[model samples]
Target: MRYLTGYSEAVRAQMQAIHARQGLGRLLLARYPAPHGMRTDRALHAFVTELKTEHLRRAPPIDKVLYDSKLQVVQHALGLHTAISRKQGARLKASREIRIASVFKDVPHDFLQMIVVHELAHLKERDHDRAFYQLCESMEPRYHQLELDLRLYLTHLEATGERLWSGSGSSGAHAGADPQPAAGGRL
Candidate 1:
């Protein structure tokens, strides 16, 4: 979906033309190479390792992780809320399994890892509470800090209309994706 970034004049012009043609703005874009000095990537990898070793107890086999360049809704951390029902599973001859889905179209790696670790934790802890936070924290010591950072970044994007997280806005801004209050964000 062509996501827009208010970075360059060209980006805005393209967004304008696309918006003029189509009623809705574009959202997803292809995966561009990771930027130089992507310390975030290293941090994210460490976070994932922590999740595997400390929090999850056992590592859940990841089936597939696709980093789509095109997807709207900014960063919809989609995943199986719960395992498939027994009846449905029997119908599909599938095991009672849960899944995780995250969109990196425009999300930073650290933020993306936060969302992923959050979802993966759900596989172990069904409810969000002390146990959940404990698990999340065990994996990522600065769990709340990272979350706040991501929220601030999103607020910045909303205020300036510049794409947040990803330089290439493949997915357009997602609605209600940001739960944190945007105190200084746009009206």
Candidate 2:
């Protein structure tokens, strides 16, 4: 329920009913079924790059993309996008990076894509406004649904402390135990 703060009372009640019956895990597992295979930073970079190329072709180039074990879900930061500028000799160079929480390493591909799409949307729209959401939808048609499902999954995890999906690529770590932050900690 903490993860579903913005949802309506009805929705919260529905989730509560499911949790009371201990069916949140079952619902999430039925919907997601499997975790994705992009476990390493290199593979994550490739995955993000492909998504960027397909959706934000004209956006700034991304210098890095990786799963950060230090990003805690309790902090409400599932993914982060950062742009850093440094004086490179006689000129300034900017590098963009996206960091996904390591908890996502054990989630479904749709959940991963939803977070990635969110970070990728930041490349063009800096604020979570209508334009930003429109951009997200452009990239992933099921963006809103996936986001709601991800929140539900987080709610399930918070309530039961059980992971619905785990496999070879999963870190199998609890989301709240990781407390460090990436540079500039802005979600």
Against the true structure, whose TM-score is highest? 2
Give a tens-digit lDDT track for model 2, residues 1-187.
6666566677778878988999887888888888998889999899999999998899999999999877663445778889999999999999998989988888899999988998999999987777887888899988777777777777677765677777342223334211321111111
Worst 10 residues of 2 by lDDT: 178-187
Q: Give the Cα error of residue 21 in candidate 2, in Å.
A: 0.7
Candidate 1 ranges with C-alpha deviation above 4 Å: 1-60, 67-82, 85-103, 169-171, 175-187
lDDT for model 1, please.
Answer: 0.45
- Candidate 1 lDDT, 7-48, residue by residue in tens: 245534644554456422122212212322323434434544
TM-score of each: 0.50, 0.87
Clashing pairs in 2: none
- Candidate 1 residue 180 Cα shift, in angstroms, is 6.6
